[model samples]
Target: DSMGDEHVWELLLPLPTTASTSMALSLLTFRLLLTSSSSSSSSEGYWSTDEFLPENRRRLRDRREKLERTLTESGIPYLPSDSGLFVWMDLREFLPPPPSPDESSSASSSAETESRESMERRERSLYLSLLNEHGLLFTPGLSMKNELPGFFRCVYSAASDGEFELGLERIGRCADAMRRSKEET
Candidate 1:
């Protein structure tokens, strides 16, 4: 509104928030009705949540399993999750080792700070490289306020089976490239 775009403001300012809320509420209500109906045998017209829920659960489980296998094949260690859409994979091994302090620089605090900065930089670089080169994106642990860097959250529930598999392959290839580059150095 402060941008002097009077036409845009005129179009947007008069819209009520209740419209969106009502739409969302009605959709939720519809789903609830269908679910309640499906739970009983008498509702012949309603969609079955029983079938949908189990199938969806199975599909997500399969995806998670496949993702774990891919990460394992890529030699990336991940935290085991009992129930979630994402896996937290540790990439700390890909980070450069912290610098060794000399006798003149015996301060542990400064060394620790430098090590953290280095880890953050390496994680950001790897995140960008994966996105740019392999068309893969992950939630960086830094933004997630993780105490340690190099831990990325990879979601498994957002894509089609083929796309998800392809994404996993891309991640594997990116890991392979990083590993090969490290070996060369």
Candidate 2:
């Protein structure tokens, strides 16, 4: 499997040695493409500004709204995003507390305190907890190797309607359990 990285150029037929024949063939193909039109009513012409139909726009809007509502109800904080379909969820508040000083042998002055590294470690721990215990997969913000900690990227647009709703439901339950567990400690 190419995994969407298919080397398409290699699959193309070798260029003709005679330059004139190649030029004629390219011109003919271009002319045919320009002349052809889609008989399907849903199909849009090349360079059409209105690529998404009204029905498609409504469906996409409904999906995004549902996902946003689900996250809000679940008490998961997320950044405001309008340009893309992905949501950058902020989960810093739900991260587990750092280890107590009494439990550690080595006295790292600032190590015991909350720092970027510590925060990243906690993010990883939370990611693993979600994966193993909740059967939910989350892309750890720490794995991104960026400054943002406890920020997981979630894509709800690609999933089917039923799948997306179920995922949201599971996430809500998982978030509840995680918060409760964190509080008990």
- The candidate that wins on lDDT is 1
User: What residue runs in model 1 are displaced by over 4 Å at the alpha carbon?
Assistant: 1-46, 96-109, 115-119
Per model, state how many residue pairs clash: 0, 0
lDDT of 1 at 9: 26
lDDT per residue for candidate 2 within 79-133, as digits (tens), equals 8666444577888777776666664444663543655666777888888887788
List all candidate RMSDs to the true structure: 11.9, 12.6
Against the reference, the lDDT scores of all candidates come to: 0.67, 0.60
Candidate 2: segments with Cα more than 4 A from true spot: 1-57, 100-117
Q: On residues 26-57, what C-alpha lDDT tens digit does candidate 1 reach at each position?
A: 45654664445545432443234555456556
Total clashing pairs in model 1: 0
